[model samples]
Target: MDEIQLTAAAEGMPNFNRRKALAVTGSGLAATIAAMVAPRNAAAAVVVNEAPVTRVNNLAWALARAMDDWMVDLGVDGVPDIWKAHVYPYSQRKHPVAFESLDRSPSPSARVAELEAAFHAEWAALRAIEPALNAAELRYMEIKGSRPVMGEMTPEEADRLRSTTVADLAKLPPNRASVEHAEAMRAYNKADAAARRKTGYGKLDRAYMKATHRTSDVANALLRHPAMTLEDLASKVRVHRVWEYDGEDFNFIMDDIARVAGKAGAS
Candidate 1:
């Protein structure tokens, strides 16, 4: 992609899909908070000892890795540049899209298994902090909702709650922290792209067109999935064999491919 188009594409897309953040439900609130506030340099340490112990971690990682590997298996070279530019550094929701795409020749299912295992291990360690996490959450909630009255509650309860909340807020969970770090990185990229776009990168519309066209093609292929009829089969082949060759048309092609693939399975 040319500098101008690259700048525009980067700026046009969101850094991370906030929708993914909705995964933080009920009890997972602690996990979410932890993930957001934890320190970067301490991820490994925290992963080993402080990460949230939830089944969702493994599930999320497995699916993420599988999706990424599947994209690579379909043959788009080197992590979709758009994802790298706009998604990867902003949140775990999108990071796997690029990393597993670049991984060499692993079957999508296999990659999924690998990531699932890794997540399991990490979560096993993370769950250990549940007690502290819950305590902190309760404390933080109390403090934020209403300031503790001097004599409304026992001095010990007040002290414990305040101290625990302070600690929790001070050190966010590892996964949560990673997400925030990625967000900051994405913000930086956005700023840089905006600056570049303002500066004369505006001329690279052709490159953007080229990339988006191929992306659209992949999308079309995915849409044509489940090829039951000869017509559908032909369309799939045409899209996959012909248009798929052009990266600019990839998105459309993939869409058709997915549609056909889905239909085929149903049949």
Candidate 2:
């Protein structure tokens, strides 16, 4: 695969299909986050610790970024010029032992594992409320006469669409919402937002944001990481193999992101 796109690569494009912020129902994305976050072992091994942890990932991002910057300054032969421009310091900075341990510790370090656990907890909380919000969006036109709050989606339908976005749900229906529906939607959304917030999803949102930033930091940092050659970078960021050596496209594609989006978010 020659220069295949790093679907979620963070140079220019940002959100890495945050809906799937690390893992799916429980697969694939762990590696994606791992690739960028924990480059050494990269979450390949099973995590045994489930202690509540925080800031570990942010620190990990710090170290990986430091490593990448270090390599960039070394003027590693294969490093991309834009990547050199991309790193902030153009030289490695000091890392705390805790942060450096993110790379040095065993694969899926206890802290990393705890971070993932926290992520899943938050991800689940957000998902629990989204279907109702989504159903409301899909059924927006009938709100005044429709169900009181939710869009009336069945568990089966919600399950099928668990991964679909509000926009995706909107696309499935042919109902033409009148301009008045926008006002209705506004009220409904206000109530919905308040109700969702009442469920304490704000904390969840903040936690996921931290994890994702760290993960994306890892992805961007990899471009500067010493072990990651351009070839390695090419392989890690790809959605999948297309034609053999078809060519690289490091740009992030929204469509690809949606395809892999799982039940989570960075929003």
Question: Would you estimate the TM-scores of all the predictions?
Answer: 0.19, 0.26
Candidate that scores best on lDDT = 1
- Give all candidates' CA lDDT scores: 0.39, 0.36
The TM-score measured for candidate 1 stands at 0.19
Count of clashing residue pairs in every prediction: 61, 4
Encode model 2's per-residue lDDT on 96-175: one tens digit a residue.
11111112212332333333323323333333433333333233322333323323555655565676688778765422
Worst 10 residues of 1 by lDDT: 1-10
Candidate 2 has its poorest 10 consecutive residues by lDDT at: 3-12
Candidate 2 runs further than 4 Å off: 1-177, 226-267
Q: Give the per-residue lDDT digits (tens) of candidate 1, residues 1-267.
A: 111111111111211122233455676765655554354225436556534545346645655665454444434454432212222333444222222222233222332233322332222222323323333444444333221222244466456556666547656343443566566667666664554454423234334335445444443434333333334433333234322344554565556567657777898
